[model samples]
Target chain A: MSDHLPSTARKPGLTSSAPSVVAAELDPPTPRKRKAPGPRHEDKRVAILRTAAQLFADNGYEATSLDKIADQLGMHKATLYHYVSNKESILYQCLVLSFGNLDAVMSEMEDRSVPPLQRLRQFAHSLALAQNNVFGRCLVLVGSRPLDMMPGGEIRQFQRRLDETVRALIVEGIADGSIKPCHPGLVSSMLFGSLNWVPRWYQEGGKLSIEQVVDSFMDVLTSGIAAPRR
Target chain B: MSDHLPSTARKPGLTSSAPSVVAAELDPPTPRKRKAPGPRHEDKRVAILRTAAQLFADNGYEATSLDKIADQLGMHKATLYHYVSNKESILYQCLVLSFGNLDAVMSEMEDRSVPPLQRLRQFAHSLALAQNNVFGRCLVLVGSRPLDMMPGGEIRQFQRRLDETVRALIVEGIADGSIKPCHPGLVSSMLFGSLNWVPRWYQEGGKLSIEQVVDSFMDVLTSGIAAPRR
Candidate 1:
């Protein structure tokens, strides 16, 4: 992944090949130079994570290897280890990274103070976008199998928290009289299951856009599949 | 699987030690006795399939092997092969068996001449039952991967046919004014995804019965999640 970084930000091995004068001009000896490594390292870490995610999605989590990820990034296996301690670490970080983004989106949605029904629609759209995105697709395709093997149960906890938030949204909708009164837990499961499975059949340039799919799902959820009572 | 067979059906190697009188009585020297191989062979085949399905569910299809299955059955690998051609064949058969049973149930539901809404409710219950069953759990866990490797396109074709039937039900419901107008393809995907994911969380003797889950799902599907308009 670092291999694709701008020549200036790439490892010294490649950057050193540039004319010495041009390199010297780009980096002036200053205290602020210390801040450069932080963002540069973070960017490289994300790049490795994104690449690993794509590989995990393409060839399942078990079948994928650290060597394959490094090969895909055009980096040495040693350099790959610098970003991630091991394959499981990569899997762990990939899941956390995707969930972090999704949690952030949900947090923003919560802050909107919209009606519960409208919140549900926004939540559905965000879920569709996140799952269909390259990173989240890996999370859904691999499911929670990686978390089962990993230590500390953080992933499971994080997932449970997400499920609870979804249930809470539904409960709120029911209270506000915007959503029908139903078993919040069951309805949440149906919503998540449907959203999670979107990546299974959704094509990038497919006939239906992600928004269209979300609209269709949300419509079905809000409006009974049965005709309105006469 | 053969190890659990009744004494009368036990392989000759194990049953030979029976008292001569009992053995003679069981065999009953007769011309028509030669025809017994038909039902006996079919029973052994079913035993092998049931055992294979259990193993496949416990351990994934790829991790399971012919040797392990034969060992589980307390039979020689050669004897196992006599019942099944190979491991893939066992997997292929396991999928076909489960899907075949579910397909039969759906067909029965279709023939009831009930309203589309009622038929959908019946379909939901049958789907939940089938997925929670031992055989159906194997199908959900292993997923359609085995079908991809299996020689014929029969499994995929069978699956497509099922999907079409589901969509047909929704379409019929819409035409008959029992179901709301919606995208049959998208709604069917949502319905199947929710139903299929049931095995992931449902425990047979858990707090909720399969009937409860089915009823909850059907309620949400038929009635809109939002409150009825005043």
Candidate 2:
């Protein structure tokens, strides 16, 4: 029963041989896959991406090679070309996955009837949760370089769409006097810079749970910590 | 005379070849040599880095190459290698120059009698300034990957040291009643995160100047845009 669950959420499996992107997908060895004679092709593809992400993250992207990725995955190097056309392809896929997932979560929150502040809190939690899977690791480890190679132009547009939504929320909050009248860009800069950069310092066993991490940031940002400047 | 002022900082007519670090000491244009070389070698190095930073920032790091860097510089492939060992070294040098200069500015502020908030302001300027210079472009282009082989240990330690200093100042501000008592880590996280990440979107000659960029961030951070609650 436990097999279906993603192994660990935020960051427990350092040496468990789970590549950052594919490890979570491996849970619960599903019932249908056992009949095939070949190794699970989907799983292998995920594994390749997982391996590629690690190599890309560990060694700078240009330094990582397909042979090395295949060697690490214990397969012929050419085998991976079937799943991904180039090393860069894996990076692009990982980013699309991360950004796509993030936008979906935030959009889902926007549909709720809650106040903008409540919505933000929900967002902070949802944002934290996305990192539990493979896509989150890729986002942090690789940074923001992949957006350039994208042919879809979807990634940037997606981000802009999301930013507009957040800005609208902020503007609403300001107009009604429900929250602070902060610059949308500044609030966003702080929120994202702190959240995006968290993966760098976050350890699985840090005193704070991911929830606490979100709360710590929200508390300061929403309600300035000084005793009301009186 | 003003045209020569920047040259006074380096050699007057030396070709601004992309100097490679392969033979670090032997290849370096010494202080005198660099001065005479003036706007040539350093300018080329700066130009190459400017082009690379935008490319690296636009595309992820792995997708960029020395050959690509040379192409952007309108130079031949072999010529690019003469400036650095490999793409990773370029990334490293880019970051090191940025970080190294930031360290100098922070220390200079440290010795001054400025208040803690003012000190923070100075630090912000120092960092933001680098984002526009030959050094900052290097740092911002490859800033997040500390464990990257090129700058590896030294780079990470330097970042940590700076982070700690920022944290300490935030704590001091809180304790002295100059600033509110927010989570020190989160404060530093938000402040440093936003400050360091500025290069991701800022462009010179854009609508906002560097000072304007710094002001935009500082304005929101120093004073909450939220109204004083009853």
Among the candidates, what TM-score does chain A have in each?
0.77, 0.73
- What are the models' TM-scores? 0.76, 0.71
DockQ of predicted candidate 2: 0.30
- Computed on alpha carbons, the lDDT of every model, listed in order, comes to 0.67, 0.59
lDDT per residue for candidate 2 within A129-214, as digits (tens), equals 65534566666666545445444444456556655666666676676567665677666666666676676677777787878888
Question: Interface root mean square deviation of every model, in Å?
Answer: 2.5, 3.4
Clashes of 1: 6
Residue A66 Cα positional deviation in candidate 2, in Å, after optimal superposition:
3.5
Model 2 in CAPRI terms: which quality? acceptable
Name the top lDDT candidate.
1
Mind giving the per-residue lDDT tens digits that candidate 1 earns over B45-87?
7678888888888777766888899899999998886667676
Supply DockQ values for each candidate: 0.40, 0.30
* Deviation of model 2 at A93, angstroms: 3.4
lDDT of 2: 0.59
- Indicate the worst ten consecutive residues by lDDT in candidate 1 chain A: A10-19
